[model samples]
Target: MPISDFRKKKLLYVFNVFFDVNQSGTIEKKDFELAIEKICTLRGWTPNNPKYAETHETMIKIWDGLRQRADANKDGQVSVDEWCSMWDDYAQNPDRALEWQSRYMNFMFDLEDASNDGSIDVDEFTTVCSCYGLQATECKTAFNKMSKGKEVVSRDEFQELWKQFFSSEDASTPGNFIFGKTNF
Candidate 1:
């Protein structure tokens, strides 16, 4: 099935607000590189650090995957239309969606687990969202909703929420807030 308007908007919000780090109107390698730098900077990882090198490799791999999968025109960038269309395909094949989205989900959860406690507390979620330019209050609210009254979100719970974020069409679903305010 085709993605709903709300789903399209949410995907676009993710693309424009988060992944398009360079504000280049499309997602390109530079966006991933910039995101790597920002994330590494936030994590205090220096070039000599193994984690920094790992981050660079991981982000580049993700960029290559996205470019190969979503860049239908082979222009080396993913535009909003291509993004939504790729997601539409995913929507039609949920198993494939889960498989493809798992890597990103794990990366995000691990990144958000700043304390390395194997779970994401509200403060950690808030901090990550804040880094993405979301309001602290909004991040707190989103964490509360996504966590569903739990003190922290476990990896399993986060996996479920990640699936919902991509698959659920309902606007009121808690998973919709997984990335903070969706604006739709």
Candidate 2:
């Protein structure tokens, strides 16, 4: 099927956002936000209440996945080399692309496991954000907004989010990796 204009635009927007954030060869949470805001604004996606804190908090949750993949070393920071490693691997092998996606999803689950006892909590939410390049204070604020009255995302919920965020129509491209469809 030929791609629809709307889908094309959305895909382009997604690529643009990722390109902008990775332009410096480093991914920072703030830059990630800027990219998201630009795309969201272009798509006219307003939050339920349009609160900056709430929006930022939600974004932190999303960033948790990508940041974890980029970190590679689990050092709480994404270095340029780590970022390059991710991009290179994805570029060279379809299997590597799928592997990265799985790793990212796994990291999200791990980060949400709070209590050090294997449960999700507010602190873990904050830690997830900080791991992505947000300052501690910023992460704390975002975590507060995100964790307010919300239960930890279940495994099913996590998988759903993973598919929603990563699925693409270009799954048939022989050399291009579609996040969930590509088996690695």
Candidate 2 per-residue lDDT, tens place, 13-129, comes to 333334336554455676657855654453345765354444456557656765777778776556655654554444344333454466545545554554545445556655544
Worst 10 residues of 1 by lDDT: 93-102
The residue-level lDDT of candidate 1 at 171 comes to 79
Candidate 2 TM-score, true structure as reference: 0.35
Error of 2 at 156 (Å): 22
The regions of model 2 sitting more than 4 angstroms off are 1-25, 49-59, 72-77, 91-184
Encode model 1's per-residue lDDT on 1-184: one tens digit a residue. Answer: 5678888888888898778999999999999999999999989999999989988988888888888899999998999889888877776766666333667787889899999999999899988888889999989988988998789999988988876777788877878888978457
User: Considering only N, C-alpha and C atoms within 3 Å, which residue pairs clash in candidate 1?
Assistant: none
Model 1 earns a TM-score of 0.94
Instruction: Report the C-alpha displacement of residue 8, candidate 1, in angstroms.
Output: 1.3
CA lDDT of every candidate: 0.85, 0.47
